[model samples]
Target chain A: DAGVTQSPTHLIKTRGQQVTLRCSPKSGHDTVSWYQQALGQGPQFIFQYYEEEERQRGNFPDRFSGHQFPNYSSELNVNALLLGDSALYLCASSFRQGAVSSYNSPLHFGNGTRLTVT
Target chain B: QQQVKQSPQSLIVQKGGISIINCAYENTAFDYFPWYQQFPGKGPALLIAIRPDVSEKKEGRFTISFNKSAKQFSLHIMDSQPGDSATYFCAAPYFNKFYFGSGTKLNVKP
Candidate 1:
C-alpha cells in the first residue's frame, strides 16, 4: 500500500513571508498530524486534524495552522516565517477512534517537507 | 517541555558490532514507545517499538529494551552494518499528540 505523501519536498521562504505545505495521509487512515523537526532536534507536535476538524494542538503559535480535507489530506500553513521556522515538516497518519488503543500502532510518516526560511 | 529525551546525539560503531540508543521519558501516562529510523533524504520509519507491559521485544536483528519503572527505553541493533547508519528517534504519544526525542545519528563503519 502507498504510504503517506507530502508535497513540495523542499521550500525556501524569506522572513515575514508565509508558506504552505501539503500532506496526504496513508491509505485507511483518518487522522493526520503535523510536526516540525529543527536541525539537531526531534520533531515537535504542531497540530492534529481528524474528521475534518482540528482535534489537538501543541505549543506552536497561532502563526501555525492546518486543515484536513474530506479525503483526510492535510495542509500546514505558517505565516510570518522566521529563521527558526526553517526545519523539516513531517506528516503522520493513523486510523481514528480505535487506532489509538494499540500501543504498538505506529504513525506512518511522509518523507517530509524541508522548509527553509531565510 | 519535551517528554522524551534521547541520548548521544551521534554514535560511531565498527561494522559487525552492536549499536545501542537510549531514551528516557518523564510521563507515566505514555503507553507507547516507538523507535524511528531516518536516512539522509528519507522520512523516519518505524524500526521497532515496545510497550510498558513488556521488558523487552525483539524483531529480527532489532530489539527494544523497556524499563517501565525508570521510564526508560532503548534500541539495540545486532550485527550492525553500514546500512544501519541513520538517525534513530525515540517517541512517546499522549493526549492525542506525539512527542519525539532529540534523535541519535549512528554511523557504522566497515
Candidate 2:
C-alpha cells in the first residue's frame, strides 16, 4: 500500500510569486488535509477537502486555497506569497468511513514539501 | 490562539530512562486525543491515541494517559532508547478538524 506522497520535495520562490504544491493521498483513502509547519513549530491546519469540496478551513488567509480532485489527489495553491509563507507543507490523508467523520481514521502523512520564499 | 498547549519545549533523558511529555487543551468538545512523533525532514506519524472516556492507553513502550477532568493528557515512553529521540506532538479533534500542540523535542542520550 503506497502512503501519502507529495511532489517537489523542496522549492524556492520570491515574494509575490505564486506556488502550487501537489499531494497524492494513500491508496484506499478519500479525504485530504493540508497543514503548514514552521521551523521548530507544530503543524497548523490549513484546510481539508472531501468529495471535491472544501469541508473545513483553518484561520489562514484567503491567499491559501486548495482543491481535491475526483481521484483523491489534492493541490494547495498560495498566491502572492509572502516571506512568512515559507514553511514545510504537509499533506495528510485518511479514510472517511460512514457518517462518523474522517477523524475516526488515523491520518497518514507524506514526507512534506519544504517551501522557501525569499 | 493555540487551543492545545504542550510543556517543556525540549527534554533530554538517558537511555533506558523514562521520558514524559504533557499537553493541555481548553476545548471540551474534543473527544479523541492522539500523539505524533516526527523526525527531521519527515512528517509526523501517529504514535498512540486515547479517548476522553479512557484514562489510559498503551502500545508497547508508548503510553497515553488522559485526564478528562483536567483537560490534560500525557505521553510516557518507557525504557527510552536513542532511536526514540524526536519531536512529539499532542493533538485533539474537534468536529472534523484537528488541533496540535507546539510539540516537544526529546533527546535520549546513550
Candidate 3:
C-alpha cells in the first residue's frame, strides 16, 4: 500500500510570505500529524488531526495551523513566516480506533517538504 | 524545552560491532518508547519500541532496553553494518503526543 505522501518536496519563500504544505495519509489510516525538523535536529510535533478535527497541538505559535479533510488529507499553513521557519515539514499517519486517548501504533511518515525562508 | 534527552550526538563504529544509543525523559507518565531511523532525504521509520512493563524487547538485531524507574531507554544494534548508517531518534508518546530526542547520527564503517 502507498504510504503517507507529501507534496512540494522542496519550497522557497521570503520572510512574511505565507506557505501551504499538503499531505495525504496512508491508506486505511485516519489520523494525521505534522512535525518540524530542523537541520541536525529531531522532529518537533506541531499538531495532530483526527476525524477531520484538530485533537491536539504542540507549543508552536499561532502562525502555524492545519486542516484535515474527510478524505484524510491534510494541509499545513504558515502565516507571516520568519527566517527560523525554514525546516523540513514532515507528515505522519496512524490508525486509531474509537475515541482512544493514547496511540499505541507506530506512526508512518512521509519523506517531508523542505521549506526555506529567505 | 526538550522532553526527551539523548546523548552522544554522533557515533562511529566498525562493521560487525555493537552500537548503542541512549535516551532519558523526565516525564514518568510516558509509557511507550519508540526508536526511528532516518536516512538522507527520507523521513524517520519505526525501528523498534518498548513499553514500561517490559525490561527489554528484542527484534532481530535491534533491541530496546527500557528502565522505568530511571526513566531511561536505549537502542542496541548488534553486528552493525554500513547499510545501517543513518540518524536514529528516540521518541516518547504521551497523552496522544510524541516527544522526540535530538537524534543520533550513526556511521558504520566497513
Candidate 4:
C-alpha cells in the first residue's frame, strides 16, 4: 500500500511570505501529524490532527497551523515565515486505536518537503 | 526542557562492530519508546519500539533495551554494516504527540 505522501518535495519562499504544504496519509491511517526537521537535527513536533480538528500542538508559535480533512489528507500552513522556518517539513500518519486520550500508535512518515526561506 | 535526550551526536564504527545509541526521557508518564531511522533526503522511519514494561525487545540485529528506573532506553545494532548508516532518532509519545531526540548520526565503515 502507498504510504504517506507529501507535496512539493522542495520549496523556496521569501521572508514574511506564506506557504502551505500538503499531505495524504496512509490508506488505513486516520490521524495526521506534522514535524519540522532542521539540518542535522531530529524532527520536532508541530501539531497533530485527528477527526478534522487539531488535537495536540507542540511549542511552535501561532504562525504554524494545520488541518485534517474527511479524506484524511492534511495541510500545514505557515504565515509570516521566518528564516528559521526553513527546514524539512515532514508529514506522518498513524492508525488510531483505543481511546483518543491514549495515542501510542507508531508513525509512518513521508519523504517531506524541504522549505527554504530567503 | 527537551523531553527526550539522545547521546553521542555522531558515531563511527567499523564493519562487523556493534553500534549503540542511548536516549533518556524526562517524562515518567511516557510508556511507548520508539526509534526511527532516516536516510538523507528522506523522512524518519520507525525502526523498533519498546514499552516500559518490557526490559528488552529484539528484531534481527536491532535490539531495544529499556531501563525503567533510569528512564533510559537504547538501540543496539549488532554486526553493523555500511547499509545501516543513517540518522537515528528516539522518541516518546505523550498524549497524541511525540517528542523526538536530537538524533544520532551513525556511520558504519566497511
Any residue pairs clashing in model 3, and if so which?
none
Better of 1 and 4 by lDDT: 4
Please report the candidate that would top DockQ against the real structure: 3
In candidate 1, stretches whose alpha carbon ends up further than 4 angstroms from where it belongs are A102-104
Model 3: per-residue Cα lDDT over A1-118, one tens digit each: 9999999999999999999999999998889999999999999999999998988999999999999999999999999999999999999999875545444667999999999999
lDDT of 4: 0.92
DockQ winner between candidates 1 and 3: 3
Residues A11-114 of candidate 1: C-alpha lDDT, one tens digit per residue: 99999999999999989888899999888788889998988999889999999998999999999999999999999999999886645553544688899999
Per-residue lDDT over B1-110 for candidate 4, one digit per residue giving the tens place of the 0 to 100 score: 99999999999999999999999999998858989999998889999989788999999999999999999999999999999999999999887688899999999999
Q: State the DockQ, from 0 to 1, for candidate 2.
A: 0.72
Evaluate all candidate structures by whole-model CA lDDT and list the values in order: 0.89, 0.93, 0.93, 0.92
Order the candidates by TM-score, highest first.
2, 3, 4, 1
Q: In candidate 2, how many Å is residue A45 off?
A: 0.6
Which digits, one per residue and each the tens of the lDDT, describe model 2 over residues A1-86? 89999999999999999999999999999999999999999999999898999988999999999999999999999999899999
lDDT string for model 4 (A52-85, tens) is: 9998899999999989999999999999999999
Alpha-carbon shift of residue B103 in model 4 (angstroms): 0.6
